[model samples]
Target: TEHEVQRWPLEPQGSTSFGLSRDGRFALLYSEEHHLVLWDLEQNKKLATLGELDADGNAVSHIRISDNGRFAVTAGQMNFAVWDLGWTQAQGLWSISDALIRDIDITSNGEQVLLGLSNGKAIYVNLVTGRRLEFLAHREKVNSVAISPNGRFALTGGNDYKAYLWDTESGQLLRTF
Candidate 1:
């Protein structure tokens, strides 16, 4: 079977980063001009442009969309922003004072986020409760992070040549690879 391919042009031209929802219904595009545009793939229409420039007037370099298409996360060097797609408003904007954010992933419900940091730590934030737990299993920069669909577990990998699975709430190490 051959699938038809369609080209959709985007505004503000040069996009440096892009992310799509797990269900393939939404897309997040970050352009070179620091514009974050959201699109509804199924409807073929623009949803919203999100995020704001930081103190230095620089936006994020990385972007991720939640599995349910309810949320999006954008990360720059030291700060990250979370947006509620349904409301088209920012849920939170936070900065990590000591460590740089290397990667991020949000839970399907959009209530939590797992952030990988340069200090080899993975931090989990409960958006609703405002509680944070840190997983300290890696010894080098944490390069990647993921949260399970149920938001019970987190998986993280780093430059230390290892990957770890952790209990998101308890911060207990489950397995290492």
Candidate 2:
């Protein structure tokens, strides 16, 4: 049996965070200088640079690429932007005045977004239909969030030491742990 190893040289910048496409074909790199770059992992080349300073003029602290690699979401303290990866363009940028965004995730088709907030709420947005739903399932800051592939369900974990699964459309609490 043989083992294979491959390495790609990245620029000598301080990377703060990164996300990879589910198929392992793309990489989203965030540097200390607030620079975001997309790399073609298989081709070993840079694909596109993404986003400016967030609405607050602060560095984006969180990044997530959709499972199918067609969408991406980036967040700062109180704002987030959704990107259409196929077009290499920003679909929308939004900010929340009442709560800070802790995490975000997008659907495979680039239409739905799930955002967990410091106000102990999870917000679901449908980009195409302009529908927004809120799920208030936690009592503390929501620290993590994820959405089902079909965009029907959401799971959120909060600083209150609880995790909840909820219906995205109706904001009904399905299960708690």
Candidate 3:
């Protein structure tokens, strides 16, 4: 299994995290200082670097890209932000109330964003309208989350040692393990 693709010399210092668009055309890398960088994979060039004013002042825990590549989302320092890549001036931005976002997943259509929080909470937001669909509480922080390719279901794992499957459209708890 050799996917050995071209390697770009990323940042030399600072703990960082990465995210790839669903279609694999775009990517994002963040430094420990909450520095955000957008990369164009197809062009193999750096597309944008979100400056200090654009990124949160502190470090981020995780990041995710929408399926349609219209938006980029990140969680950090008690904040969850949404970025509109297509817009030129400070794209769309928003914050979550509880701010425990640890891991995130986007729907294939890019209309919905799901977040797993550090406080054992799960949040599902409708990106298109910036509305919250569900706020699920857990006993421990959520560690990871994934949405089915078909957009039919979502699975979330938490430090509470549990995983849950939910209906994407209806926001119903489908199963738990």
Candidate 4:
């Protein structure tokens, strides 16, 4: 048998949440201190910070890593930030809508993002083109958003006791449950 492990400090682990890269080489750590730290598990240490601090230094409420481990999205107070994990280390920050972001998820190809908002809006953002499409998704705050495994659709649930299915490319409502 074989074993794999890394040293993640237990001290000050304030309200921590994490995302592991698909290849299992790295981990992204977010804490209540308003910081996101990337760790190189193979080498057993921190790699770099995922993104710059927000204006108000708000703690990250939600985050998702792409299927290839090449991209990540962090939900900010008034917007969301996408991080390019490629060597070039580029990033895109978008304030596509004014609704308060409640949660977010990146697609398998890392091309788009679906965000659930407190304003009852489900926003789809094109990461490469920076295009946005937002529509009223619920009567109250949306609790979650998920991309289908085949990448053809999205599912979003809210406080209104409903879950919606949306076309990934067109952002059109496909079903209600």
Candidate 5:
């Protein structure tokens, strides 16, 4: 698939991940060296830069914007943090185990975040309460995780080569593959 392309070159501080807001109004590119640049896509220009997430030289694994574009999630090796798009610093919404986080997913309602750990366990955290929700399924290194659009269930695939379904509330195994 060949298509026309254009390029504009600018120097950004460090390694970064790009995420587009749900409404497409804003785009955020964050760097590993503790900086994030917000661009206004419609205006075709850089809007603002926030000196946030300056924790370590740890590379960011994933960046996710909430469905409404009001919240954002950033993942690093030791810790994961969530930010309000309107502000530079992240709100104290949730935190994960210091086990080299591999992946992160936010619910459409912005009520929960699912984190996949390098040690093979997947945990769900409630944004409002900052509590780790009960999760029971994976027995080995979890390779991937997904949640239903309605946020009723989660599916996980891992080194075990098995996919499992679990209830979001009770953390009970609903099915296995």
Candidate 6:
């Protein structure tokens, strides 16, 4: 398959990780020095660079951009935050107590953030209200998580050798396998 490649010629020189929004218009890049930057992929421009997070000072390990390009969530060893793209501020910032977040995905409509934790929990946070719904999905570490394309359901997998289907709105367990 032929694909187009995008490059950042002046991209900060360091180990960096980025998350692409579902629409492929934006990228949230985290550098080794714990710097977070928003890039406009469609226009090939740097949109915004957030100030250093003085809360924990830890490097972000993972990032996920919502489908509608409205939000970007980032997590590190001890911090997790949801950025409001419109305002360019972290709308919901948490000093996480459990283990680090292992993986993340956003609901199709970009209203919810699904998180997989190292402490065996699957959590989804509502961006609008900053409400969080959490449950013990596994006895061991949760390794992966994904939301249904319609934004109504979720699935999670973990070290416990099982997968779970959940209702996003009510945070109810629908099935376990």
lDDT of 1 by residue, 120-141 (tens): 8899999889899988879999
- In the range 96-165, model 3's lDDT, one tens digit per residue, is 6675668887665556677787777777777667677664746888889886645567888987788998
Model 2 C-alpha lDDT per residue in residues 2-37, reported as the tens digit of each score: 766976765476676677899989988777564778
- What value of lDDT does candidate 5 attain over all alpha carbons? 0.69
Residue 151, candidate 4: Cα error in Å is 5.0
Clashes of 4: 0
User: Which stretches of candidate 1 lie above 4 Å from their native place?
Assistant: 1-4, 51-55
Model 4 root mean square deviation, Cα atoms: 3.8
TM-score of 6: 0.80
RMSD in Å for model 3: 3.4
**Residue-level lDDT tens digits of model 4 in 1-177:** 776654456226564457777788877767765377777788777777655536566666677888778777777667677777665253766774567888888877667888888888888777668677875868999889987544568899999999999886776889999
Backbone clashes, candidate 1: 0
Better of 1 and 3 by lDDT: 1
lDDT of 6 by residue, 37-111 (tens): 888887888788874444656777788877677877777766777787767787667666777788887765556
How close to the true structure is residue 57 of candidate 4, measured as C-alpha lDDT? 64
Per-model CA lDDT versus the true structure = 0.84, 0.85, 0.71, 0.74, 0.69, 0.77
Models sorted by lDDT, best on top? 2, 1, 6, 4, 3, 5
Better of 1 and 5 by lDDT: 1
Clashing pairs in 1: none
